[model samples]
Target: MHILVDRITEKTGLDPEKVEPAVGIMLNFIAKNSTREEVETLLEAFPAAEGFLAIDEATENKGLFGGLASKMNASVGVLAALNEMTTLGLTVEDIQKVAKETVEYTREKAGPEFTDEIVARVPGLAEIT
Candidate 1:
């Protein structure tokens, strides 16, 4: 997890502290938007992803308004994830960099076949990463 987080920080120039939660939010969004089989393969390839997912779950809706905001954004997947990432101080470019690095890392850990399958299946994913 540290290795991946370090790699993201090095490449994206984002704060090390922000990388984990950002990645977690992105992964959670991907998992929600993808098929069950795709998610299983993704998780299998990157077991550390579970920890990131937990991070997102833990910090999802905190304040009084956060819960309402989350509910309003629930039907809008990418928008919600984008909101969460921005809340963490990540810019659009930063998010893209993180997503690309994450995808590249996944390709290295898993295989191009596995990574490509997930990307192709998930809408709006290829545009970013």
Candidate 2:
């Protein structure tokens, strides 16, 4: 997790504290939308990943009004993660840079073949990178 946080920080100039939760949101988003094999590969490459895989339902659904009345949901998976990242004060360009750097880091850690396989399984990931 630190590795990912560091990589994101290095690539995006985001604070480590903010990067931590941003990456967690992305990992949780991926785990929700990806296949078991896809998630398992990432977990194997990044053991600390499991800690971030669970989405907090309370936080996930909370809205401006902090209740169902104002609860407008972001699109699921990477889009949702991207939306959350924006709340952390990142621009779309920063998100794209972060996404590309993340994939590059994963490729270095887990090999291109494995990383590519994982990316192929996640919807809209290609668009982001």
Candidate 3:
């Protein structure tokens, strides 16, 4: 995870702290929209993924409106994740860079087959990443 974060930080010029949350948001979006089996494979390939998801969950559930926001996230899909990332001070371009780097990191950790399947399965993900 450190290695991946370093790579994204170096390549995207995003803050180190922002990288994890951005990546986590993208991963959570993917998980929510893709097949369970494919997502499981992704989690297996990136075991630290669970930690990232947990962090995102904790961050999302932090305030009075957190619970409601989380529920809205479920119903709203990628928009919710995008909103979360933006709240972390990321722009659309930053988000795309993070998504691309994350997918590339997953490919390196897993394989093209595993990464490709998830990206293809998740609608609009191809365009974003």
Candidate 4:
């Protein structure tokens, strides 16, 4: 997980701390939308992925300018995840880079088929580029 974060940080030029939450929120969105079998396969492939999806009180507190995001009716998806990453001062291009790095890394670790299934299932995920 840290390796993924590191790669995204380096690729996107975002801070490591900022990258963590971004990764968490994105992973949370992906896991939430994935089928049970898909989620199980992803978890089996990357044990630390569950940790990335876990949102603590601290992370929840940071949502949408100190939790305003929770007040809004926003479903976790590619757009929502991009909004979260943008709040961390990332441009759309940066967000795209992060998305690319994330997908590529997951493909490497979890296999291309699993990664492709995830991207295909998540709404607007293919548009990240």
Candidate order by decreasing lDDT: 1, 3, 4, 2
Global lDDT of each candidate: 0.78, 0.66, 0.78, 0.71
Kindly list the per-residue Cα lDDT of model 4 for residues 2-25, writing each as its tens digit. 898888877667888777777776
For all candidates, the clash counts are 0, 0, 0, 0
**1-129: candidate 2 lDDT, tens digit per residue:** 467778778766777766666666666656666678877877898777776555333256332233332233323445556777677677788777767776777688768998787677677777887
In model 3, how large is the Cα lDDT of residue 30?
A: 79
Write candidate 1's Cα lDDT for 18-107 as tens digits: 889888887887887777887788889888888888998998864234555335543455666767778888889998998899889888
Q: Estimate each model's TM-score.
A: 0.84, 0.73, 0.83, 0.79
- The residue pairs in collision within model 2 are none
Off by over 4 Å in 4: 55-58, 61-76
| Cα lDDT over the full model 4 | 0.71
Per-residue accuracy of model 3 over 43-78 as CA lDDT, tens digit each: 888898888777776777433344453466444556
Model 1 — which ten-residue stretch has the worst lDDT? 62-71
Which of candidates 1 and 2 reaches a greater lDDT? 1
lDDT of 1 at 75: 44
